[model samples]
Target: MLRTNIFTAWIYRLQHTDLSSKHTAVIAELRILLIDENRQRAESLTSALNNSRYKISHLASPNISLLKQVDEIQPDIIVIDIESPSRDILESVSTLSNYNPKPVVMFSADQNTDTINQYIESGVSAYVVGDIQSERVKPILDAAVARFKAFQKLKVELSDTKQQLVSRNLIDQAKRLLMKKKNLSEDNAFKAMRKTAMDTGQKLEDVAKTLISLLNTI
Candidate 1:
């Protein structure tokens, strides 16, 4: 009995250690899509992030086919080095955010509040306004990844909440239609819908949507 207990304790400790290790793992060796028009700045950034942990892919500027490149390369993160992030660039980044979201670290010379806000609203994760050193690159990237994770979590929660609200509205509308058309009480209306859903082996939302569509057609 004592040996079994010790073995159980050892297993628990191993699991606890593994959880800690996973937390530290955070982001893996990321495939970075580095965008910089200036050749000199690009070279400097390449040298700075020349570590085994990062596989850097370089792009000169935001082109018409930047989205195509993103689809193909599918980099974990995007690092942009530019004098001032243009409206065109910000729009392209926003497009990327909509389709395939990823952490974006933008280093720009312009310190204008409007530009900074635009970058953030457009989904740029880390916006460094001024010249940043090579030594600061890794830390900045790590921070961006962390922020992106938090933002993504918030987005998921918001989307779920919105979906729930829409589903509730749909069910309520369907119930109202049934009550008026069938001359049934509220509880009876609900039971009727539930029975239909169960009989058809369909989701409540799907059943509600179908009822609504039929009612609308009439």
Candidate 2:
């Protein structure tokens, strides 16, 4: 009977935890900057996106310095309508991706597959080719934003994982040193290390790193 009650409580907890995990707020309304050389085309694109959950801004010139304007607005996405790829525009996109959280999307009428691939590899998150339609713009924006957030989250998790692995390596090396220096069995050494960690109110990994550093100095 006790076992059955424990299982029921476990099931209840699992269901509620899964539901909580699914709840993430939709991204806030974004500021968007449209960069294109054609004034009419830029306006059309901006107009299409005006009613979106986005505040649209337009620039009719692809001047490299115009990126500073984007920084001031702190746009969530930068959409570049490229009639043709130029070195200056490519450099600007590369710089923006390295220095900012927001990702850039490149839309080209040229539809040159090789060029589009190059833009994507150069840090443009999404590459849309051909004429832009109002219906398609929002979905593309949504996907690019989602992809960028996922990449950022994965990067943070990877960094955390690397730190954990480094900590574990240090702990294991310290444990081995303790076994050899004290002429103690591995199990006994581990117990001593754990006890010391508890008494010092420090994490085992931290204690291990300190022990290893001390030994190295000696």
Worst 10 residues of 1 by lDDT: 1-10
Task: Report how far off residue 63 is in candidate 1 (Å).
Answer: 4.8
Model 1 regions lying over 4 Å from their true place: 1-22, 61-68, 83-90, 93-98, 110-123, 183-185, 213-218
Q: Which regions in candidate 2 have their CA more than 4 angstroms from the true location? A: 1-27, 62-64, 82-98, 114-124, 185-188, 191-204
> What overall lDDT goes with each candidate model?
0.71, 0.69
Model 1, 76-192: lDDT tens digits are 888776443543564565674666677877767665522444344333465665655787666556556655766888889999999999999999999999999989999999999
Q: Give the CA lDDT, 0 to 100, for residue 45 in model 2.
A: 75
TM-score of the candidate numbered 1?
Answer: 0.69
Q: Highest TM-score: which candidate? A: 2
TM-score of each: 0.69, 0.71
Clashes within 3 Å, all models in order = 0, 0
Candidate 2, 2-23: lDDT as tens digits: 1223223324434554464368
In angstroms, the error of model 1 at 169 is 1.0
